[model samples]
Target: MARPQRFDTNQLLDAAVRLAAAAGPAAVTMSAVATEVGAPSGSVYHRFPRRTALLAEVWLRTVESFQQGYLETIEARADAREAGCAAARQVVAWSRAHPREAALLLYGAQDFARAEWSQEHIQRADRGNRRVHAALASLAAALGADGPQATERAVLAMVDLPLSLVRRHLRAGDPLPAHAEDLAEECTAALLGSLPMAPSVSGSRH
Candidate 1:
């Protein structure tokens, strides 16, 4: 039987994530990841041909994992308001569970050097973007967000608010408080509640 490959792709990606989170994106070199994982540099190169590939995989993996649960949480709720609140909570919960990956995410995708990524990586990133937009659009429609302003407000309540809450703590290298998820859910509820109610149809009632 052939000897099993000692270093798996996930181990390299995990090392890259830790490097990026601790020392910023520039620290995520192929050699650095190999060193971090105590594997030969050839092992990393075998899995990822270049530094760009490594960075792209790390960023994409983290983002995809995060979006999976977020999309599910929002879609599973029958009520739009509840969906929005759940999405906010999901952000906090995912971050708390994956603080290192979350920290790297605080720097945004551009920091991953997307321009140097292969076309396949770029397309994967675009698909994730579209999925988020579609999910938000569905939530917006369900919430009676007819106008651009209304839709924008809905997006803010569900996306921006919760992201800002996590970004601040992650960027600062501070630990999120135990109540962070609750605070995010409460803030989401408040913002969603404050949105103007959709105008009623103008009709004579019997």
Candidate 2:
């Protein structure tokens, strides 16, 4: 029987995530990840093939992990307004729980040399983005604010705003406050409340 592998793909990616979070994407070299995990460089190379693949995996894994929870949060609530608020709150809560991963996400994909990523990696990133946009569009329609402007507002209220809150604290290396979730939910509620309701269609009586 073959001996089980000691180091796996996720373990190496986790090390890369930590390296990127602590310094920047530039710090996530294959040798650096191998050293961080105390694994042989061959292990890292075997999994990633090159530094570009390693960087792509690091960014994609973190983002996919985050989006899974975020999408679930939005879907869990029956009420669109409440769902939007919960989604916002989830952002802060997730960041608080996974500060290192959150820090890594603070940098854009471009910072991870996204231009060098493979076609498969680019497709993976695009699919995640499309899923997020579709979810926000559904939320906007449920809230009776399905116009382009309203959908944009929904994205801001539920996604961008909460990320900004996390970004500030993560960039400063300060722990997110206990009230961060509440603050995020409150801000989302406010923005969602201000959306212009779509006009109702009525049948004319002959």
Candidate 3:
């Protein structure tokens, strides 16, 4: 009988991601992943002793890559205010472009039963989310959108608009049509317009 070869960590992880996307995380067992990747189950067990290890790797890979893109996009903006607006726009574009990745992250992150992550891993997750947050805060101040309350106003206002729109296009099983830009523009305008204008003239009479 021929001996079996071990699968590399990346290949196993890729299989895990694929399995999760297709059948959710429950399908990501060593046996299933090995079958998915055409390898022996022993190889997966050798690489990841516990199932949590594999899940963590999959979550970390997805979130970290996304965080990098968000950081780059936010940092590249010339104006903090524009950066904030662009951040919302970029999220819509990203969600539209990479809906599966978004879905996986949403599903993975929500499971509180997941393992305790490493400090470095936790920091990476924070860094990914904080890009949009910091940019939004800076932009809000720069554009007179808010002072301390982000969730009730700016964050709430912008996030759901794009997310809901993305969900609609996705559930319909259709690519974002060309006319989608019109909807995006209208959403962007409504969100930006709804922000409270700066306190009028600071010292002017009411």
- Compared with the true structure, what per-residue lDDT tens digits does model 3 show for residues 57-167? 788787776666666665676554445456666666676666666556547564522456655656766676786576555555544565555434566544556566666
How would the candidate models be sorted by lDDT, starting from the highest? 2, 1, 3
lDDT for model 1, on a 0 to 1 scale?
0.87
Candidates in order: C-alpha RMSD to true structure: 4.6, 4.5, 6.0
Rank the models by TM-score, top first: 1, 2, 3
Candidate 2: segments with Cα more than 4 A from true spot: 196-206
True-structure RMSD for candidate 1: 4.6
What is the Cα-based TM-score of model 2? 0.92
The parts of candidate 3 lying over 4 Å away from their true place are 1-6, 115-120, 148-151, 171-174, 179-182, 196-206
- What TM-score quantifies how close candidate 1 is to the native fold? 0.93
Q: Give lDDT tens digits, candidate 2, residues 45-99.
A: 9998889999999999999999999999987776777788999999999898899
- What C-alpha lDDT values do all the predictions have? 0.87, 0.88, 0.64
TM-score of each: 0.93, 0.92, 0.74
Tens digits of per-residue lDDT for model 1 on 1-206?
Answer: 99899999999999999999999999999899989989999999999998999999999999999999999897777677878899999999999999998898888788999989999999999999899999888777777778899898889888888889999988776899999899999998887886654444122010
